[model samples]
Target: MQKPALDIHEIPSPGKWFLLSIQHLFAMFGSTVLVPFLTGLDPAIALITSGIGTLTFILITKGQMPSYLGSSFAFIAPIIAAKASGGPGAAMMGAFLAGLVYSIVAIIIKRLGSGWIMKLLPSVVVGPVIMVIGLGLAATAVNMAMNDADGKYSLTNFSVALVTLAITITFSIFGRGFFSIIPVLLGIIGGYAFAYTQGLVDFQKVIDAKWFAVPDFTIPFLTYTPGISWTIILLMVPVAVVTISEHIGHQIVLGNVINRDLFQKPGLHRSLLGDGVATMLASLLGGPPSVTYGENIGVLAITRAYSVYLFVGSAVMAIVFGFVGKISALISTIPTPVMGGVSILLFGIIASSGLRTMIDDKIDFGEKRNLVIASVILVLGIGGAVIHIGQSFQVEGMALSAIIGVLLNLVLPEAKKGE
Candidate 1:
């Protein structure tokens, strides 16, 4: 489905472009930085790498797909697991392999066309996969909000988180026009102010930071202690399969918003390849993997500005900020509970989007097949079911749930509407 074409000129004025680009930057900043904060990677590196990745994506996709690439939440579990056993090097290896999987899939799509993706992961499968991505993180969000970083419950932090969350929701529901698209930023500010008032914020880091400094870059493969582990790589590679569904969904939504068939234009293979290569590059630099940012999509949906230049400008801005250590330090001072507050809302929106996908597609829950697929997926994903395979391998959470949903959808026969 497509809407009417945008008519505010192919390029906005320089001033407008800068303002819009800043909006895009803010839209993506929260999730991008959060990935590193959660995974213990350098937030500075993540920002720079994501900026570079977004630019690479644009160049490879021929500036056709107007999306920003930012840190992915999908790799949080896998990266954390790898870090536990083999540290950040192992996590980088895992993320690197995941990027390779995306590239491989892109190659396959280039040869085979995109129809098979639909047959394999229909709405019945994708809807639950998305839901799992959101629900699976619910506990983490709650924990961060209610408990201190050391796992001790803190009433102070919880109260701060509540304030942030309430303000975010209020803005999302009642704010109009462009402001409506920035609930995350508003929430963070509102929460930050409250935390600062309570003396939770430490401004020394920000004060000590230089206005401009080089990002601390690391090459994971070169610095790995015990070398790369094939097991870790293989374990993380399958994550791309889940993210591919999200990639497709994002393109569909963006296409709908801008009234353009982006998938048909640049083609999903190009988009996949671009994102894959971007993620690969980012991982090699010890930064979190990148994905199409939903926040930026919200910006696009409201502004109705699909110009590729806007994203380019935003990427450049992000890269500039990445070099400014002061900015990173300031963002870091946002406090855990404040982030937790925003995350609860952000994560819930992710789950709701999945529901919206199913609803918009008119997926019939009356069918036993649909019911079973969704039910099993929800339980396995949200209930924390893990499947062990052999002595050295296991699958659980979103990845496990996604694979199971796809298989079930493929095996089950579609019921006739009247039958």
Candidate 2:
């Protein structure tokens, strides 16, 4: 018997729908704004990119499943590394290429099935790599919260920072209902309120800022000075491989939650294309590359309102806020300690995701070969290992770690039978 046709428009009451949309918005709020804040991109543009990306995802997925696409945290380290080595524009170029990488992988998945892609990125390799990605940036997030971009200690009130961090941690660990999902937002609010009491906030920026303004979109321009570092490009490309796996995993989770095979229906190809296009769009507009947000999955589990229209409402709200310069200023003004406090949990969650990936796959951890591969990748990646073969030729850090992992897997002999 054919399953009853699911109703895409069967939304709950109008009031409930709006409330649920707000829940999703809050779930995605902290990380979305935090991306541009860290990368030195216009926060308004990040908002626009996220809004546009989410909308594109919905349309491409044919409204079959509900999810939100937002600014990716994985790109933060890469962007910073690129800016230090090249410039901000170079980082954008690398990110743009990364989007293209996603497209190519998507096409490959379409042709060969996702199993082939999974073989290249098994749980052991991906798990440690992702954990390293988070732990690698742990110090940076803490440092930023206490100091300004200039490295000066603007946060004279260390107590406030501590309080902010405490609030975020407390709420994240023990808070109930929607509050738990929004610990970062609450922490920000708590920190900002404390800052206001202490006269730390500069209201002039908020007052002087225009109520409505266009997003400050910038185009990527090629430069010969840095001369297109192949090392940087190659380093960033494989990161996309991990993100693509995340995309597929998210799709599967959402499919089960909503009781629809989104991968086969709207087709995984189209969803991948949509994500690629959105990331390219974000990169062109001077924002970090975009990715499907997993936090929205938490929202889905909580609300149990699997309607796509709620996501549509979120997209509309985010776009409307994107045009508001004052709102961007307010978000930009969030105190660092609060962000630091929040990052304590957020970054940990990122690392935990890697662990979950490994656990979910039921990786054969006892296998000597698998154990060796995972250990080497984790240590090399997190230890800041570098390889230099003369002046102009070198590979280092996560790039080197990823390449070494892949080579080790291919070259190493397979596990013996009945070992």
Candidate 3:
């Protein structure tokens, strides 16, 4: 690994702290807010909880693993599912349960090495499930890009989406260095500006919103009481399996980047605890579940600034930004088409990531069993196949596909040792 500009434990000067931290804030800002915007959670609360979660993570990891926690795109579909089946309360409850799943896994990884988990959820299972997570949302992106307030198809909105997509693609493929990593942020801003000229953006909400006020929170007990719903549980808990795998993968990549074996030093269990506890905290406060942001990882890689102090400073700024009502209103006012435009690229990138994972690991489709595993997973997940356990609960889509993939991998025989 390269020598980082800032060491993980180094405390920068007060001036450097503010400047370096703000860079991370920009790095994580777009994707973090986008999650809650898609899921109907308050963006302000998401910011607040993510900041708090980052602090908690730093504490738990003993500042050995320097990463920023933010809203997870993986949970977007399931949160929408849980919320639809029950309500916002149910969504938060399902998220809490998912966080519990993380804690349980952390304990297991602590007791035993993570080898068993990798065996259970090999690339064959995880790859396609991740693809399902991304492709499943493809329609949502298109619909938002084309639909108006009344859900009617509008060519005008579609144009905005197209513009947004083009700019994002330009930055992603053509832009150099730090600019390339932040295409999502730049695309949204460009699209919003374009929409403003066309009379598509409505700034009345922003104008009316107070400069300083408490951002509205959708608290579990206070907003709505949560009930045990197998429907929500079945829909959500299986997704945690995928995310835990994601967490481990992130640890590996980050460890590679920082020239420190994060898993060994902080220990995966303690770091996982930080992520789990952060998720639980977010659900309690009506924020989406948190994950270590890949965007911020990119920022760290480019800047070579690995300082824990930078992360702390950034997290503090996020919490501060959350209370500023003007920020909340401004975020809310971003046009749906603009969101949709960026989302098209975002979701597709997710699906592409699964394929990239397979390619990176040399997953051989020439092997019939491997081919079968991947084939079944794609169809079941993307085809929206459902398996009903009872009247009230069912496993479907991504969750169902993930469970089936694991079972099939377990049952399938390996090739001859000679072969």
Candidate 4:
């Protein structure tokens, strides 16, 4: 098997570090900015918070785990819902609570082992929930890709979206090495260029932007605070379940890549605590919730540059970039069609990953117990089943489904042997 070019502790030369960190920056940039854009948050704040989040994570983990925290896609819909219900303040409130959920789970895992959590969630529960998270946004992707700002279908916009998607898929399947991993970035660039040719991009934003600007930071209750809405909390906090599982899964994958049991050495609790802290920090600062970016992990595996210092450089660069007015302005100018095109692939991939999880775990649909759990989750999630609670708020969609799945898994009996 191939090994990383540089080991975790090995420090590269100044020049190499700069170049390698740039690679990680671009690898993370596309998806990181996309989340903020979709959720009506400022991309610049996302960058700043992402950088700060990573630094905090590294510090808390004692630099044993090499992970870059960025805006998490899982929270896109939740953030939007929270914002719509009560405004950005309520959204951040939910986000903060979501991070708290992570911290709480980290504490639980620290006290107890991971065995009980795994038993509570198993593939049957997790797989469909993951699918719902993705498929839930299918119409949103299409509307963005095909519709104009007026929400009318535009053939031009549709064409641009499809072209972007095509470029992304082509790169994903056939591009070589580093080119393959950065397909999202490449696709966005390609689509943006095409959209420019069609007069779809507005250059005024970039031209008018200041050279240096501080990212707008919105703290809950500082500017605007809404009344407590359990709906927002229920909407946002439950997605933590998916992301925490994602973090643990990535830890296992990273350990496998480096031929070391990270859970044993650095300890799963420490890494999880680091992630939780980073997320809480991000939410407090008015950025979207952060997660361990798989894009950076892919970069580490491909380049074999596992040094923790590299991420430090990347984080610093990210923060600096956040202060550059032009970068954020340019990122904003990227057309909805361009994003929609890539989002089509991304959202689908999210759902497909659910299938992959089930397959990897060999979840048997033939088993009635497993079948019922998955069936309920997929319907409740995708069908947008909402349960009203009193007049103030209610549980709906993914959160409701997730809660039901966990309960069903716990309540249902185990499958018989060779029934």
What is the C-alpha lDDT profile of model 3 across 127-153, one tens digit per residue? 888899899999999999999989999
RMSD of 3: 1.2
Residue-level lDDT for 25 in candidate 3: 88
Q: Model 4 segments beyond 4 Å from truth? A: 1-3
Error of 1 at 362 (Å): 1.7
Tens-place lDDT digits, model 1, residues 1-419: 44423332367789878988898998888788888887788898998999999999999998878899999887876788778877887787788778888888889889999998878878878887788778888888899899987899999999999999999999889988877877888888999999999889999999999999886666853565535655575457767877888898888888777776877788899999999999989988889998998889888877777778888899998889888989988987889999899889878887887888799889999899999999999998888777777856767676778778888988899997589
**Which scores better on lDDT, 2 or 3?**
3
Ranking by lDDT: 3, 4, 1, 2
For each candidate, the alpha-carbon lDDT, in order, equals 0.84, 0.77, 0.90, 0.89
Q: What is the lDDT of residue 350 in candidate 1?
A: 77
lDDT of 4 by residue, 107-225 (tens): 89889978888887788888889999899988889999999999998999999999999999999999988898899999999999999999999999999999998877887567666
Residue pairs clashing, model 4: 4-304, 5-304
Provide the TM-score for each candidate, comma-separated: 0.93, 0.91, 0.98, 0.98
What's the distance in Å from true for residue 188, model 1? Answer: 0.9
> Which residue runs of candidate 3 sit more than 4 Å off their true CA positions?
none
* TM value for model 4: 0.98
